[model samples]
Each structure stands twice: as structure tokens, then as C-alpha cells.
Target: MEGLYIEPTETSPKVHFDPEAFSFEISGESRPEDVRKFYKPVLDWFEQYSNYLYWLTEKYAEGEKKLVQFHFVFEYFNSSSAKYIMDVIAKLGDIQKASPNAKIQILWHYDEPDEDMKEAGEEFETITNIPFKYIINPD
Candidate 1:
């Protein structure tokens, strides 16, 4: 399945999802005027990928596990963006639950000295049981 890659804009974040590597990242601020339009494709891509992965695993019948790693780093996101973020996390959680044998990591990166960002990461971590890695990126 093809992955979705969106370039970052002044009012949005960069989205990189590579099914080959099973790695994904969304970083930067996300407060686009049309939040639904901005996030619909992302949500759709995740659903498609999840289904593809499941099908591939079933067809291969391999004992080896497939893992997906997601990284989220946002400087500032509006309320609309926040809901999308939650939706993304929920989808990831569902995937993880379905594939108990697989490993999924959700890393939250924040700028060093940005207390608000750090706290936001913590809050997200609390809401979801998905394993989270809080990273402090240095300038």
C-alpha cells in the first residue's frame, strides 16, 4: 500500500507515514482554517494502512510481528487539531489492541524548555495507554 506524505505549511504540520518501515510522524503546529479537510486524508490513510497490514499478515501467516511507530510533536495546535490528534491516537490504539503480539510505540517529542509542550505530551500519554516516549529536542 502507498503511504501518505504531506509537506508542512505555516499553519499545519508535516505528516510522514511509511508502511515499508512502519514508521509515521506528525510534527509542527496544526491549526488550519479547514481542520476537517486537513485531517480527513490522514485518518483515511491510517484506516487503509491498518487494513492492508492485517490482510498481509493473514495472507503470509507468519509468526513474525509487524510493528508501527508513531511520533507526534506539535508546537501549537488549535482545538480542532486536538480532536484530530485524539482520533489518530484512538486508531493507533485500536490497531495495537488488535495485534497484541505486535509492538507499537508513540513517541512525543517536545522542544527543550517548552514546558507547555511537555505537559501536553504527558496529558496525551495519560489519556491513552499506548506506550509513549517523551523526548526533549535540543536546539
Candidate 2:
């Protein structure tokens, strides 16, 4: 299955979802003028990816769990983007729940001293019930 990749812009984030490498990342700012338009494709991609993962798990890795890493490295984002971010995380949680052979690791990256960012990650963890490994980026 093909993955999705979107370059970051002044008002949007970078999205890189590579199934072959089993790597995913969403970084940079996210406050696009059309939030829905910007995130709709992302949400759709996740839905399809979830299905693909399910199939792959059942067919190939029957007894083994495949580790998938999702990285989030945002410098800033607005309220509008937060809702979609939550949706993305929820979808991931759903994927994990549906696929017993799939394991997801959410890596939330933030610069040291960004309390608000850290708090946001905490809030996401609390709401989604998905444990996130917090990584402090160096200057």
C-alpha cells in the first residue's frame, strides 16, 4: 500500500507516512486557513492505512506484533488544528485496538521549556488513553 507525504508550509504541518519503512511523522506549524481541507486527506489516509495494517497483520504477522512509530514534532499549532490532531491520535488508538498484531508507539517531541507543548501531549495522552513517549529536543 502506498503512503502519504505532504510538505510543510507556512500555515500547515509536514506529514510523512511511509508504510514501507514503517515510519510516520507530522511536524511543523499547523494553522492553515482551511483547516478541514488541509486535514481531510490526512484523516482519510489514516483510515485506509488502518485497514491495510489489519490485513497485513492477519496475513503475514499472525503471532508477531508489528511496531509502528508515529512521531509528532510541532513547534506550534492553533485550536482548530488541535481537534484534528486528536482525531488522528484517536484513529491510531482505534487501529491498535482493532489489530491485535499491531503495536503503535506515539513519540511526542517538543523543545525543552515548552511547557504548553508538553501539556498538550499530556492532554492527548489522557484523552486518547495512548501512552506517548515524550522526547525533549535540544537547541
Which candidate should be chosen as best, given lDDT against the real structure?
2
Best by TM-score: 2
The regions of model 2 sitting more than 4 angstroms off are 60-63
lDDT assessment of candidate 1: 0.81
- Which runs in model 1 stand beyond 4 Å of their true positions? 58-64
Instruction: List lDDT for all candidates, in order.
Output: 0.81, 0.94
Q: Model 2: per-residue lDDT, tens digit, 43-122? A: 99988998899988876545688989999999999999999999999999999998878889999999999989999999
For residue 63, what is the lDDT in candidate 2? Answer: 69
Candidate 1 versus the native: TM-score?
0.88
* 83 Cα displacement, candidate 2 (Å): 0.6
TM-score of each: 0.88, 0.95
